[model samples]
Target: MDMRETPGVTPPHPAPDVFGHVGYQLKRAHAALRAAMDQALRAHGLTVPQYSCLEVLAARPGMSNADLARATFVSRQSMNVVLRGLQDAGLLTRPATVETGRARPATLTGEGRRRLRAAQEAVYAIEARLVRAVHEDRLPALLADLDRMARALSD
Candidate 1:
């Protein structure tokens, strides 16, 4: 059934206002993506942040906890918690104490890479589903726009 034809159906805001705003829609999309990621990673016994930490560590081994926090866009304290969880799970490892500096460099164990590989399959599938929602020709532009938006907000 068409939403427009339903009785008592109305947008929360006018067409040109909040309901149609880009930032509002983006937030909604982000929420949906986060939920999807959480569900996908759950089967691997990992949270989204844990999966994120694993992914970054896979790409750049020996990253400090602070570096992982920045790459994952979480606070240092939060990253420390994630790291401790991963360590306890035997997925990743860090020194008992910082050898050179205050930062402890983290690296994935063989099990970490194995789990990350499995999780990547599921996460990449979700990403592909989202990409398929848009026109093929617009994918590059859409990605570029997202990058630009992040850069703009960061700056």
Candidate 2:
């Protein structure tokens, strides 16, 4: 028998309105953040992905392309292209051949660090604006809630 027709069973509830749904709100915020980052990074001659890659590398140098791709939430193919562009721009370096494995770790050049520092100023300002929208005391709770939501979905 169909579950919906089973005795004592309840029908599924209708989905919430898009404007009222948490997932929808999260997506809207993500879209806005991406747009803001794109505009901010353009002045530094970087794309969102490129800036993400650089930011990751600065924190953890010598990361393989695959590692960087996963860290930046991009595809391996896309990361290869981003790395190549940065290498050509003299912002990063990757050895022509690896001694032990297929993954060639990438590191930022001096110029890359300088560019990242400049871009950080712009990106951090945008984040500051976002944080300022919420009450100071609520910020920690908000971050914790976001983390919990992510963990729940991931499981």
- In model 2, how large is the Cα lDDT of residue 27? 94
State the number of backbone clashes in model 1: 0
Per-candidate TM-scores read 0.88, 0.88
Candidate lDDT values, in order: 0.92, 0.92
- Model 1 clash pairs are none
State in Å the error of residue 18, model 1. Answer: 0.9
In model 2, pairs of residues that clash are none
Q: Please write out the lDDT profile of model 2 over residues 1-155, one tens digit for every residue.
A: 75335588443444444465678778999999999999999999999999999999999999999999999999999999999999999999999999897989899999999999999999999999899999999999999999999889889
The TM-score that candidate 2 achieves is 0.88
- Kindly list the per-residue Cα lDDT of model 1 for residues 60-85, writing each as its tens digit: 99999889999998999999999999
